[model samples]
Target: MFGDMMGMMSKLKEAQAKVEETKKRLDTVLVDEKSSDDLLKITLTANRTIKSIDIDDELLQDKEQLEDYLILTLNKALEKATNINEAELAAAAKDGMPNIPGMNF
Candidate 1:
């Protein structure tokens, strides 16, 4: 019985390791956001790192508004990326711990 318990524990540990690895990989995925007017584009990774930004030349004519637009676009992009990352992590956690009773996994 003790050996059986030990074996089960080992398998659980292995599952945990796999889940962590999968989460890490998903965390590196990227998301892109474009402004409604298509004047600005921003790309961010699931870890909230900005990958790149593209701005339309026509939109650059208004310097003050350009800054605001860029800021808003980046903020929205970051928010989206964060949400995606969280969902993926939550899913992985649930899948990894599904057998735990009474747990919201």
Candidate 2:
């Protein structure tokens, strides 16, 4: 039983390492989202770090409209990044997890 526990601990450690690595890798994975009218564009990493925001000249003419567009586009981009980050991290963790008795993942 102790041996099994030790092995399980090792597997957990490895899984944690893999998760960290995946997070680092996700920093390079970019997600792009734009407004419906293409007046605003957002680029972010899978880690949910904003890389850039592109706004059209027309958007600059209307402050309120620009704010609304930025909000919508940034929300969409963040959602996409969150999905990607979750999926990749889950995959990394699941792949490294050790199979133990009576524990259903």
Candidate 3:
């Protein structure tokens, strides 16, 4: 029983390491979002870090419109990034997890 516990603990540690490595890898995965009319574009990493933003000249003419574009586009980009980040991390963790009887995640 003690040996089993130790093995499980080791597996859990390996799983955690994989998840952290995946997180670092995700920083290199880019997600792009653009407005419906293409007036604004946003780029972010799977880790949800903003990389860049491109705005059309027309958007610069109106501050409120620019803000609205930013809000909508950024939200869309973040949603995509969140999805990618979660899926990758979950896969990494699952791959390293030890199968203990009666335990399901």
Best by TM-score: 2
C-alpha root-mean-square deviation, candidate 2: 0.8
Estimated TM-score for each candidate? 0.72, 0.96, 0.95
State in Å the error of residue 45, model 1. Answer: 1.3
Winning candidate number (lDDT):
3
Q: Which parts of model 2 have CA positions greater than 4 angstroms off?
A: none
- Rank candidates, lDDT, best first: 3, 2, 1
lDDT tens string, model 2, 21-59? 999999999999999999899999999999999999999
Which run of 10 residues does model 1 get worst, by summed lDDT? Answer: 96-105
lDDT of each: 0.78, 0.95, 0.96
lDDT of 3 by residue, 1-105 (tens): 999999999999999999999999999999999999999999999999999999999999999989999999999999999999999999999999999999897
Q: Residue 7's C-alpha lDDT in candidate 3?
A: 98
Model 2 residue 105 distance off true place after TM-score fit, in angstroms = 1.2
Clashing pairs in 3: none
lDDT of 1 by residue, 11-102 (tens): 66766876687667865788889989998988878878888899999887999989998889988988887788888766665554525446
Better of 2 and 3 by lDDT: 3
User: Candidate 1: misplaced stretches above 4 Å?
Assistant: 1-16
Model 3 vs. true fold: TM: 0.95
